[model samples]
Target: MTAKYLVTGASGKLGQSVLRHLTETYQVAPGDIIAGSRKPETLSEWVAKGIQTRVVDFDDAASMEKAFAEAGRVLIISTDALDRPGHRLIQHKAAIAAAEKAGVQHLLYTSMPEPANSPLLFAPDHEGTEAAIKASTIPAWTILRNNWYFENVFLSASSALASGHWYSAAAGGGIAHILRDDIGRAVAAALVAPTEGKTVYTLTGTKAYSHADIAALIGAAAGKKISVVEVPLEGLVQGMVGAGLPEPLARVFASVDTMIGVGGLAKVTADYKTLTGLEPQGFEAWVDSQAAAFNALVK
Candidate 1:
């Protein structure tokens, strides 16, 4: 059978979720999907279900070319190579070049929101990848600019709940954070029913929430008062470093808050609904669903 859809990074959380949506939710045949990953053996479960698995490494041109050879639509999930500085861009460019050479019909990329001007540390990689995709000879392409994930709150929220204070530099800025599963569903929908020509979709929650607003939600969910302590970007970075985080990761955390403070993630878009025909989950609802996790932090 010809592979109609190919998803790179198929073993990762977002990739697995997208694959599940394609097979279970959209009723796409497993035989029509190609699940590609660096370690093809890790995808044995998918392979068991008749989903063809291939070893596709963004850094290896031959692997990427072979992976895209039979795919009509290819999804290039961004890699987590931020620690290596320019390596992520190099890998993404190789993937795009391979897809173009394979003559794929449509190419879809998972990108961060506002990469061109965002203050996020990894924005450059996404920006460069998007540029490369646009410059390539691929006949069609779609860019999915995903907002902050709701699950990312646990990176800082758990520690904050333990201390009863959430220190943040994002004072009044609101972020329209969406769930990862919602993003996965939207991505699967895009691949299943692709649009004509070049398209860019900024997927975000229907509602935006400020730091104070998130703290309030946490307070309600955990049944305890969680204070929002506003701090300067430098102070936030220093505090994170003092709390045992490495300098580079701490800087990334602080930069995210600084971006939030400048309303970088405040855009509320309807792209999710437009693509999946479902409303994205609200922040309050997501918080309530994770009440057990939040309450555990206080205990």
Candidate 2:
């Protein structure tokens, strides 16, 4: 069994995007990369392209170990198993254990920024997963601390566009949001690049924007003026619940704003450009690109 590069959660958006960049942008051969997913059937297109597909079920440790066999490098795209508390951390640990058992040499993972001290609801999962990776026998690992995606703003942006007010719990705090695809490209580049020891990179846009700043950008792009309404954290959570989001999920989402208020996602770093030698898409550019979508929301 020859060693090859393995990417877990290959069916997901980030996973799929990373795979595309790996093959298209980085020119990694299909034969050299293995796309791992629980439902291998969904990866038919990848198979057609001559890429190897494997069943990497996090819940089934034996299956994961088998999937990791002959995998020299593995990139674990964090799963979205957030509905069940502690389940995601368990899944991540299982992947780490499987990689170690299979003698993986280099490992990589997608993580949230400042998870160790952030107030985000799912920070524990990332923090624990990072700890497990560090404790593993794998000699080298890369942790990509991805910031908030501009797409994530859509959750609240639609409502704000309609109401003419962007209600925010994060007072005067800013977030340096990068595009999801940008993060994926960076991850793909890092996976194939050489690394001597443990490395961590915080991937983010070139600048940070507060709620007011974001509202202004949206207004400029959509031809409508929008105001930023500062609300308490509890009020923000309640507002989301009123907007038909589940209470638990609403709180989890609102915690992002709370985290922002404390400067959690505010930092802008050059780590993204260092990885891919490319500038991440800026917020203004993202807004312009989504102009049609924003105008539709306004109407």
Please provide, for model 1 over 36-99, each residue's C-alpha lDDT reduced to its tens digit, 9 standing for 90 to 100.
Answer: 9999899989989999999999889999998899899999999988667789999999999999
lDDT of 2: 0.91
Distance from true position, residue 78, model 1, in Å?
0.5
What's each prediction's clash count? 0, 0
Q: In model 1, how large is the Cα lDDT of residue 226? A: 82
TM-score per prediction, in order, is 0.97, 0.97
Clashing pairs in 1: none
lDDT of each: 0.91, 0.91
Model 2 Cα RMSD, 1 decimal:
1.2
